[model samples]
Target: MRLTDFTELMRNEFGTMASDSMLRDHVLSDLGNRTGAVAIEEGVDPREVWLALCRDFDVPRDRWYLHPS
Candidate 1:
């Protein structure tokens, strides 16, 4: 997915402030223990970062992919 899509998904799922905090502070093990923003800057896939976030936060499996109502 594009970076824009990743940004929107993060905001949609975690609110603007929380998403920003996570991207800045949450270290993702799957990305070599790098924060989301750093990992993305180093060329990690946003989808991979999102999945790592979901795993770290224990987000429900059903919610991994967005579903329109």
Candidate 2:
């Protein structure tokens, strides 16, 4: 997914402040122990980062994809 899409998903799922904190602070072991921001900075796909976040935090499988509008 595009960075914009990833960013929007993060905000939509976690709210702005918490999403920002997670991107900065939550170390995603699946992404080599890098925070979401760092993984993205190192060229990881935003989609992978998003899924890692979901798995790490136990976000429901149904919510992994964006909702239909």
Candidate 3:
């Protein structure tokens, strides 16, 4: 999904607190780790990142671009 969509999902899932930069990073790290996407190299795929976050956070699968395992 697009960055905008990801941000919106964050807001929807976490409310206004999601916009906090530090909290955002914490969330990313938590989700990234769960999907083994922690490397986060330059060539990392956005779809994979989105999938990781969605799966890790239990964000309704229907709202995600990729239904992560």
Best by TM-score: 2
Number of the top lDDT candidate: 2
The list of candidate 3 runs beyond 4 A from truth reads: 1-24, 27-41, 66-69
Task: State the TM-score for model 1.
Answer: 0.89
Better candidate by TM-score, 1 or 2: 2
Which ranges in model 1 have alpha carbons more than 4 Å from their true place?
66-69
lDDT of 1 at 66: 43
- TM-score of each candidate structure, all chains considered together: 0.89, 0.92, 0.45
Clashes of each: 0, 0, 0
lDDT ranking of the models: 2, 1, 3
How well is each residue in 1-69 modelled by candidate 1, as lDDT tens digits? 788888888898899999999999999888898999999999888888888998998888787784332
lDDT of 3 by residue, 1-69 (tens): 454555565566657565334233544553434322232343445465655666666778777644232
Global Cα RMSD, each model: 3.3, 2.8, 5.4
lDDT (C-alpha) at residue 22 in model 1: 99
Better of 1 and 3 by TM-score: 1
lDDT of 3: 0.51
All candidates' lDDT scores? 0.87, 0.92, 0.51
